[model samples]
Target: MNKLTLLLFWLMPICLYCQEDYDFDALLDSTSVLSEQGAYEQCFQILGDLRQYLRENPDKEKLFFLNIHEAYDYTRFGYYSKAECLFKESIQLAKELGDKWNEAYAWYGLGYVTQDKVLSNSSLPPSEEGKRAFFEAIELLKAEGDSAFLVDAYDAQGYAFFLEGKFSEAIEYGEMALELCLKLNDCESEPNILSNLSEYYLAIDDFSTGKKHLQASLKWIKEHPGEIADEIAYNVYRNQADILIHEGKIAEGEQLAMKVLEYAMEHKDPYLLRETNKMLIDYAAARGDYEKAFQLQQTFMSQLDSLHEMQLVLSHDRNQTLLNIGLRDKEYQLLGAKLYSQRVITWSAVGLIVLLLGLLSTVFILNRQSKQFNAKLKKEVERQTKELRISNEALERFAYVASHDLRTPLRNVISFIGLIQRRLKNHNDADLNSFIQYAKDYANHMNRLLNDILDYSKMGERRLVATPTGIDLNQIMEKVFPMVKDDFREKQGILEVGLLPTVYGDETSLIRLFQNLLENAITYNDKETPLVAVQLHSVANGHAVFCVSDNGIGIDHAYHEKVFEMFTRLHNMEQYPGTGLGLAICKRIVNDMGGEIWMDSSEGAGTSVFFTLPLIEVEHEQQSQENGAKAAMAVA
Candidate 1:
């Protein structure tokens, strides 16, 4: 999987919102129906109803399911805080019920939301929380002998990694998710994973594959039109159009976008309508079709007016719900008070009863105080979330600028190098070998720049798949080491491998990851005889830990994290024959695999790098040694 796949998967339909005034089944049916009819007002109205109903009746099994649906609703309406709250609440419920399937679903909900947040901000929030939630859910399912949702857990884990700009890891988990989906013949899951994988391809401008998966999704959606509503179809077409436009199919993309917008207007989906207008304006303007762009803007202004009108309707509906809740509460309180007064007077056993009531009231007041305190905590979380989003946006913009502007020079260098190579062919001097190598180095540098852009651009915009395979890191290294043996020998480096174990992730990404890490160790060495050691050890809960330690110029503590940033090199390119992208790509790969990357060194001592891959990504067939027994019988 790649960035394009991740991006598309980031918008995968890991969501379902419950509907209003209706029963659970009714809400589901109505929401589906309204959406099919393109009646977004009615569709969302049903969602609001379901939200209120679930809030009022948390005891219902339907309400438990509503937890997922409510999150979707809140998210669709741009209430990220509320959406996050709903996911947390549902996860809490799943934890209490010890329900593995639902728990995994909840974790996916978190991943889906986090993925969106990342796209909007240009980076994912810290993923530890998401990974922990997924692993915990996987544990529950495993204990209960329910591996049905194992793929979902892995999928979420992969997504958690992907958001942190871990494309390699994202691909690993995403593949797992895809494999599981295929095994289960889960059409719904298939498209999602495929879409996510497509995002990774897009990240590398592998648009052909991106378009392939997106088209696959569209095809499946058409075949099983019942699975998704018109809203989803609307989104599918709009997204496809964007890709087509970006990939140079301007006319087709424009037609698709316009058609979707037309459909939205037909169905009264004002939000989509508004967004389509903006896209049209930009699309037309970029094509120098100023008249068309101006016309589209005017059309959009009309839609805006329509949207305002629809908003009033929605507001009225919301106010009505609040009024109903208040009225019901007030009525209940009055009736209870009357009953209490009568009981006190009639029973005349009042003194003791009244004393008890007073005690109860006092306790209740304290509880309310605690609830208020909790509310304050929620507010704080919201504030932090907002701040993080703002910071992420800044980072994303900077990354975009850095990628384009930085690549511009590297591209020129590449072009110039080609020119030089062509010119030098006519004059084969004694330094021909060196010149050829220089050209090769320049091409490699350009490739590094492109990879760096993919790394930076990947943060917060891709979905991950986690598919466990029978991987032997030992064997993998055996193969990889031979390829790099000459390099190590040339650098006079003593490379060693520690006890290796099999781990799960995307094969290509992992190979690239290790290859890059090894290259990094060899490329910038202060040691006369550079020493590189690679090891993989099994960790508790089925994780395989990988470490690559090197006897090289140690990095400062302050620059440890910065070193992993794309194009961020402490030393000059002249001093070190590098594009300053190796470490950054390394960090991204580790992160995408649901792992962390950090350094341990004293500026002069060698640097040790360690990363962990959790057991949740493993298949039941080849569980880690310690976890094998636990999974064997359960799988059996």
Candidate 2:
């Protein structure tokens, strides 16, 4: 009888723990339903309540799940920093508790948030950090023998690969994910995985395979209708339309594309709307409807611009919300301080009248401070709003310029191709050669334009944060001179090099800057013999300034700064045979290196480009000495 009692006692805690877990799981299911219904705030409130209860109860197991859900919720709302912090905390807690399932989920949440951050900030979609996190999650889930979360992990891997443009790997992983979903009997996830696979196949131009996957996804969506069904079906239909359009089923593709647009509008999915508009624009262009195509293009650009503006607004709102929360916390602290002072006054109430006067003064001071804080917050919000508006307007103007400039060359290419095709039927070799040459020239110009544009845009992403490294500008110039040596020899250009100094910067960017300037000097010169000279001099604070001067057909005073604006060409394509992106690229590269670049030129005179760079060795030595002094002071 004693032994039986001992067994029951031992089992009691186990049974209680299981019951607690069950209760938490049920609440989690409710939260999932709310989230799926798009009631994120309500879902968050429920999660908050659960968290409060967990805080009171102090259950490590329950806290793990709560943190994971909260982190994921934050990520969904673009609270990347908060989500990242929570995910890291949850991961540590899960590891301490030996909860492998929650650990995997935490890692997956972190990865998803990182991916979203990359996508928001960059045009490119590839994310190495996200891929690593998802792979780690997959391994953990596999070890746990968890089929449910494993499906998601596999799908995320596939999605990452797709973004990275690894089409074959994406298709393989997508198939693996779909198979797992089917095996797990997760009908809701199965359709989305199939849709993902279809998109992958479409990316690789495998229309038949893409069609097959789309059919499968459509069948599943129809069989198991849910909120996810609508979202995934929208993408599936869009891909199907794309495949149809590629296969010459124009009317059918247009119909499907229109349906996708309608669904996107109903759901208010801006991304999907933009994608559908792009498809419609392509269709119009294909059907030889230039007017319709132009209108659709304008609408597409407007929508894209608006989407960019909306993103800025959302980011600003998030910051504003955080600021308000901080203010509330500060108010709470001030209230606590007031209460403390009042308590002290009450305890020391040798004179009740003095205590009353003290309380009154405290109240007045607190009110004034609160008013001041509120006023400051209002001013900050207004300033940020104005700055955002200015940035958006500038971006819109840039987009217009880019579109107009890029389209002009493409239009020429198309016209030349059409001419070649029509004249090819007449069997005239001479005309064919001329048309083909024109097409080739335009193609080369387009290639140069695209390269320069890519370089300009990638400035923000590349290696721009490292400490300056010492490099000899003379060696850089020598290396660059060879690239334009033929042009110099052909033009009989007299290239003079003064004593160039070693400076600190990205060597590749510096070389490209010199190469472009020299190329421009040679290419733009109409003189029988061109003269180009480069010289350097010492500047303040361990810096060297350099100037590249050329006796080429100089720029007008009015167009001096304009030359640095992208695609601002004064000469026609026939005369220049180049895109007007070189100076702009050079200026951006110079600025990125913590230097300035400007032109000193006038019409009929020579042009001179000047820039500066830091002297790296001297700067590094000075920084070391300063750090040592700081450390010595701290120790003292």
Candidate 3:
């Protein structure tokens, strides 16, 4: 089966509920079509509505099935982690209901969804977790004697084996699945399995058997046209033509190949067209048409070269969608909270009015107490107003800087794209390639800038809720080293660690802080022997001070404060490469943790980055103080 057909099959929702009762068949069909057409937002909106409806109605079975579909949708579109979580939920739901059938399907979903590697040796599973899930699924389905999903499970295993290069195992599994499909009268899967088997046979050099399977698949397609997927039918034709060409049936093979090529061109399927061109090249070579072969090979290479550009665009779109989805989730949560808060405030105002009416007579008698109450209320309101203003101003400033920085890279990309287009028209391959590479670089830079902006915006949102468990600096360095090990090796840099202390902070944030500081230390250095030293200072006043000293070209005192500002860069891109928000993020993280971060250095001298983290003992002391105050209040 072709990739599109396989994706459609894999994403097909396994409905355990009655479509007539739900009256959602039309909706499901529409969403499925939209998903297939790559209109993910439309699909998501429809699915989201269905999800909300299910939440209100509380149908566990329908919801579970819907979750599988949604998970598969995400999986098909490269959202692996999100898909894995949803598949896990589906498994749990099926287990809770003791529904082995659904559980089996859920496990099957997880097997494919969570498998990271495209292929692995039979000696080692593509993904051990995925392999285990597949086995568990097969066992459960086999126990229940359920052949409907079992056929699919077997087919999946066959594909898995094929990808692993275990051809014998793949054939075994494929035959098993085909047998089950025939027994169940499942025409839909039978043809696909036959086509798959034909490929396997061809790979093993059993042309006779391969031809038989291909012929069988074609016969099925001709007989059951409505049941066969378009891509599957196309594959059957393509493979048959390939076999014919290899068997010296040039005229017949060329006709079939041309038909397939026409279809691919009409559908604008560059990949399939490229494949057809390759097969034609082989046919031309067989016929001793060397000139035609060379021309076809050049066309194939051009198409193959364009695939990277296609992939780059696809990657950008997927990333943008993921980012938009994340931001939307945050916005939704904030909107919900704001709505709740507004409702509370509205009710509170009504209550306050009623209280004022009831206490109108007693107000004059309690004037002094009322005055104190008014004073406190006014002070609280003023404090909140000031905080709101500061937040607004900060948000506005961030937006401006983010837009400007983001637009600069985008402009570079657009300008280079135009250059490449013009060069393409002129047929200047060298200029076109140069401009294409530049555009790609600018796109990458833009992506990085956007990520940095996102980080800066999110820093305040996560207001460092100090965890009770302290973070060990040594462990953090160990964790962070791998991320920059290549850079360190490339620069021949050395790092020295000293005795470190446990500090109260968020581990993830601290890791980012240390990583940025260390990276900058290595990146900015012009020393003959670059060295970065991390050490702990004596604890004082409930804080643990630390220093990351580096033998690098030091920053001047004039630009020290500017370094902690968003998008602030003291050096040009040629001299240093970064989004310039790393130190800003580090500063925000430190301040959120109730600590300070600063640099102590001057130009031409080595730099030392000093930061302080709250001592774990200080957190304990604060907790004790809070407990004592609560006890005193209770006694009073």
Candidate 4:
């Protein structure tokens, strides 16, 4: 009986090992199927379960497959960083296991993820790392005689080249992929390769060759309907429409393009909608339907704007997801540390039973480790905070550049509207003229809004570069008065000055600050004879406070704070023709100069704006004068 028991115990582990292996294989297969079917949630659940199982069982081979499957799923979900990390982990495991095939697969996955990462983050330069990874993958796959994956690798390389605008190189690799796919008798990827080839050829203006490839791709899809996705087939058809239009088959192309547009609308695909709308616009222009063309252009621009807004939202979500992932990683690290501590405590308990000295040593080690972990965590938090600040600054710069670029198109639109108005001047159609005038007005308003946005974005950048110097408020007021002198004179406004003092700040910023305040005082006033007063409020703590009070229309207490916000307006543009950015800009300038600004006013009462600026010390002023004199004497 004892001998039988020993034998059964030995057999039991082998049986359990076989059963575990079978279960792992089944889960992996299910995950692959789920991924293929686009059931990513279920796929991820299986992957997560597999990951946990592998963690306990410690199977590197199984872990490698798990990482590969999960990585691809993550890539599909646009989590490029997570995918890249998993691919890298897979590569390490493959290397340890001496599995060249899987290693090449991992490298290919890394390259693919990197390509997407670079595309999504346009600020990043083209990724040579991705290219290098593809090359490594190709070489490895070639050595292993894996033609199936090699085709994908070649296709990816071609796509990368296409993205970089290297058309010829793209064609070269694309042909290689097509040839390999043909030899392998794989019709599955053939249509995709042909479609890509068509695009490549079209890029180089080889219309005839491009059309041939496009036709071939369409034929393949038509013959094997289920092989290609409906979206892909529609895209292929859209490309055909583009070619047809380019070939001057306007009527036929318009018909097909309209169908594709319908499909795009039904699916609500922004990319497809934009492309189809763009093609339709061209079609309208070609047919000499200027009115239709203009309307289509408007639609295109609106769609483009919507797409941009969506992209921004997606970008925000992506950043939030990445932050969450980072936090989760940190949490996992903490959990691991806790687990290690628990193990250490359990060991220490054993040691305590054996020797109290061992337990004491363990306690000391734990204390030191806990301090080190805390210090590391603190450093990490600081680093992340700094990175967040940099990211915010970058976003500000992006906003500035985007708003600036938008002005060019807006200017063009306004110019076109002006041309239209001039051309229609002779027609004298009242309704048409009124519509044109409305368009012109709206365009002008948009222009003003964009200009304000640009100015607002520039404030932070100027603050970073501006050097503070002793500035004479009296001189600043003199310079500012002229810019708004016409308005004051036109309104018969009286500007009173009460002996302004010199303060330390950027001269230009100070000039703008007062100009904005003075302009606001004059513009917002409902009084027939507007009276604006600049007074020295106080001087203390090395800073001087100044006030600009207006005897015009005053703001309500509820809107006192709101008035300082960008784009905030108490009245319509018709009543007050000014961008609401003036006060906001003033606030930013004051804050940048290490001061504060506030308003004291009530509805229908005169308003008072108070602001502060640093005061130049007497010693510094005298020293500056002496230095200036010395320079003048040396120059003479």
Top TM-score model: 4
**Candidate 2, residue 401: lDDT:** 55
Each candidate structure's count of clashing pairs: 31, 0, 0, 0
lDDT for 82 in candidate 4 is 64
Write the residue-wise lDDT of candidate 1 on 208-234 in tens digits. 877887888788887785787566567
TM-score of each: 0.38, 0.48, 0.48, 0.60
Better of 1 and 4 by TM-score: 4
Ordered from best to worst lDDT, the candidate numbers read: 4, 3, 2, 1
Off by over 4 Å in 1: 1-106, 109-174, 195-200, 242-252, 264-320, 323-327, 333-636
Query: Every model's Cα RMSD, please?
Result: 23.5, 17.4, 19.4, 11.3
Best by lDDT: 4
Off by over 4 Å in 2: 1-59, 118-129, 227-229, 262-270, 283-291, 329-636
Worst 10 residues of 2 by lDDT: 627-636
C-alpha lDDT of all candidate models, in order: 0.63, 0.70, 0.71, 0.77
After superposition, candidate 4 runs with Cα above 4 Å error: 1-98, 114-121, 132-136, 164-176, 182-187, 201-231, 243-278, 335-343, 346-351, 402-446, 462-636
* Candidate 3: tens digits of C-alpha lDDT, residues 172-250: 9899999999998744788889988997887687989999988888888888758877766887788888898899887
Cα error of candidate 4 at position 464, Å: 4.8
Q: What is residue 183's positional error in candidate 3, in angstroms?
A: 1.8
